[model samples]
Target: MNDHDKHIRVHIVDDDPADFLIIDELLLQSKRFQFEVNHISSISEARQELIDPQCDVFLLDYFLGPETARDLLIEARKVHCPAPIVVLTGVESGTLDDEVIQLGAADFLPKGDMTVSLLERTIRHAIQHKRAELELEQMVKRDPLTGLGNRLLFEEILEGSLARCKRAGTRLAVLFMDLDRFKEINDSLGHPTGDLLLLLIADRLRSVMRESDFVARIGGDEFTILIEDLHDAEDALNVARKIIQAVSQPSAIGGHELNVSASIGMALFPENGDAPIKLMQKADIALYEAKRKGLNSVQCFTSNLQTQLERHLNIEKGLRHALEHDHFELMLQPQWDLRDRRIAGFEALIRWRFGSELIAPSDFIPVAEKTGLIVPIGEWLLQTACRYLVKWRELGVSHYRISVNVSPLQLKTGHFVETLQSTLKSTAIAANLLEVEITEDSLLDGHEENPKVQQDLSRIRELGVKIAIDDFGTGYSSLRYLRQFPADVVKIDKSFVSGNGGEALAEPEICRAVVTMADSLGMDVVAEGIETISQLTRLRAMGCRMGQGYLVSEPLAFDEATQWALAGEAVSR
Candidate 1:
């Protein structure tokens, strides 16, 4: 390329004519890269020159008459100048370099050390560094996979829109959408297919929404849309329905036919919330309710949803505090052996003690799982349960194992096996005496074949620890999991075991099939939630060897369970 074609247009803003003449001479001597120089004597002249799109870099004098180079730098940035500004200063001070940079100067050069090579290098470095900074900033605001604005950019735009709406006395809407069964597609078809599906979804969203509206991919399978200048709240609903219809259509990706649906929750400006944070939170609450209802549904924010959201936030805070303060307690419920009628083992249930009251697991466990608190809380449970089991063994409780439930989040964390091994090592308990209970839902949707999950289970089993599937029949109940997952036991859900009166069993065929499958696989069967004698009798007939429920004995405190174990009760009254 010719020298002029490789030229960098340089703008010099200095009040001193002599300083500009010296810089112009140095630029001509460099000879490495062509310099097309423009010299302006005042900040006002530089501001006008900054508007030129061809300007590549700026050289500003640190002191320009009454004003400083900092003033001109601010003016350049105000005009959204893409060029970098290098400060040329006559004064030599220790902090002047930092001061110039803090004022947005890309580089600071002292006049005493001015040279042809130094000047050229400083100019080139400043421009290259500023370009990199801009690129990094753009990356931060965008989702790399979907090439869409991310949560950071979404929040920025939402704040601006909310402010505009407040002044115009108009309405805006924030819609939070979460895709349903997206994980299933990811697990079954692979992540490459899932990513392609998300790209297609982003395109569809852009096509359906008006050009004035904004859509952002906030997270995996989660997106947020902003609708401004809305005439009525119903306008947001109509937009939401359109997005649902567009997303629900089947798409072919990566040689797989994929189908997905979205649940959207919307919050209106000046009605649901006035601030960005509050509106986003309320919209999330609505989205959660929509998911609870079913896929492809929409829910508007309500006062009741806010109340629930507040309670959820409180529970999450309490859980964090409870973990740090040692405010959690474990209760052990006995698992009875139908054949031997003795305590086969106990399931360790975690309970949160909030002040004077005890909170049920059903109330807070879901919150923990949702907020990613479960990973830590679950590790605590495993370590504590192992310690308790060691204590029980020292107290002469033998031939009994303690089962701890594992959250799907915990398994997905990629360190469950390490945690289990570390707990066993620290507690010095026999690995075989600790049972890890996972729900069927955790293993469903191709998770059984997931290499990470399979490796985790295989390593755990290799450590001599037993693995059991908890609440087996309640989830997808894929029989493939029995053959694939390294499960030693299957716990039948309580729903099927309950309400079997006279000769009419609630789900006799399903129970028999599960037992038969377990027997064939050489896995032990445990029936959960046996409340009546008839239920227990029915389970024994179905060949379920172990059972746990209210009928076995309510989950007891450590001391009470110790007493029960010492008494060696064969059956509950």
Candidate 2:
């Protein structure tokens, strides 16, 4: 079918005058069909007329002088003509039609015994098909639910925007937004509620932005908003504030009133970044800062954010390097038996030496935890501590139990029991020597149901690994987890040990009550942060079996700790 077969305009490019006349008469005879026919006898004439934007489809005979219909089709393809060209042919036409279709023609119709209905059908079908294709192409570039550009579309749009900004010397902003505590809501409620909340959030975000701006949800609870044509930093700040207000509005789900908040980080063009990844990265750094400063706030990308992000990246890199190079060191703090007045065990604390600078456990420990470096770091600590136990035995020093603090995230991230078993095998450290301390928050979720935690702790205990509740009374303000778990010891938090007004008076009374409570439960009691002679005396009087603190000496270096261990001979002497 050629261009003239429809109600819309169709260009007819055929050199044969009689065949063109016959086809035109047939189209006219079909009174139900409407078409604007432009007849041309030469390829040059057809190309000129069909090139017009008004031209919809092309009808051409198999052959044109000097330029075969194939040549015209190839040229048409180059010109990006939207029109579909249909070739008219006979015997060779069938074979050539396939060739012509390969040249970008839409379809082919045999000239012999062809009906106007067939011609018209093919023409309408092609137009409808093209329209459908265009629609689908548009949909691919957009997010289905939010109607914002998807990641694929965002890249294309962002590239163009970057180019334009570079040429015009203009400023642009890219805002990275993450819904705070989204996982908590999903776990507490259900996935359906989470989805509903997300949709509501998307709607609210769209309502706040201008038509010139773009927003896209890239992952679960993560979104990127590009604010184009910004006048200044203050303008971008205003948009960020608007975004915070709009998303912070309360969203009701499953008949429950829920308030959701977002952390927004924004980076500007040229100043923050000139590329997509760099821009998004700076925005992400800003978002991290916002989250760190207590969620539900906005942070603009600055050199400070860049520097901090660089430092975190450096730390992450350094950790990986340290592990590869075996640079991490462990310090042991003695866990003393107050009744025996001897070092019964020690707690393994991790430290790092980066060049001449010593990084504290307090600084890099959380960094490791956040970046999932803890899994490896913790494993190393466990193995190294176990190795120390074997070394002490080799040196003929009295054997002592060693305690290690297990991070909650590390516990949940892998097979905790398997990791423990592996470390024991590697270092030949007895299961009884290794004690794992879990905090109260590990079990407390502001609710009573803690089956997973209970089961995990049970499995660890089954493997003969001793369990202790560290910083016991400071968390949850309740004794529910302690009651549920079969913990071997409950270490009183340093806060309680500090005592009121720096006097050991209130502490002894509290320790006496705690000791009494543990006695009732048939569990051992250990006091932490004992510094003064009166405090130690009070603890011993209260029947606390073990204690750890600065009184024994702050967590000491390995050499210092081993020297202190050798001092056991002094006590015997």
| Best-matching candidate per lDDT | 1
TM-score to true structure, per model: 0.75, 0.62
Candidate 1 lDDT by residue in tens digits, 1-573 = 465535889988888899889999989887788899988888867765654446788888888888888777776654446688999888988998898788788999999799999988898888889889878867899999888899987887787676557656899999999899887677566678888999999999999989889999988899999998899989999999999999999898877777789999999998987888999989988998999999899999987987898899999999999999988999999888776557778899998889887888998998998899999999989988887877788899866789999886787788888888888888888888989998887766337435687678888999999999988777754565468889999988877877554434467678888899999999999988777777777778988888987766889888887776776764333
C-alpha lDDT values of all predictions: 0.84, 0.77
Give per-residue lDDT, candidate 2, residue 205: 84
lDDT of 2 by residue, 453-568 (tens): 56777888987889887877665434443577768888888778865537573455667877887888788888888877778888787788888877666777777777767775
Q: RMSD in angstroms, candidate 1? A: 6.1
Error of 2 at 175 (Å): 3.4
Worst 10 residues of 2 by lDDT: 442-451
CA deviation > 4 Å runs, candidate 1: 1-146, 150-171, 184-199, 250-260, 268-279, 411-416, 443-453, 499-505, 571-573
Give lDDT for model 1. Answer: 0.84
Model 2 quality (TM-score): 0.62
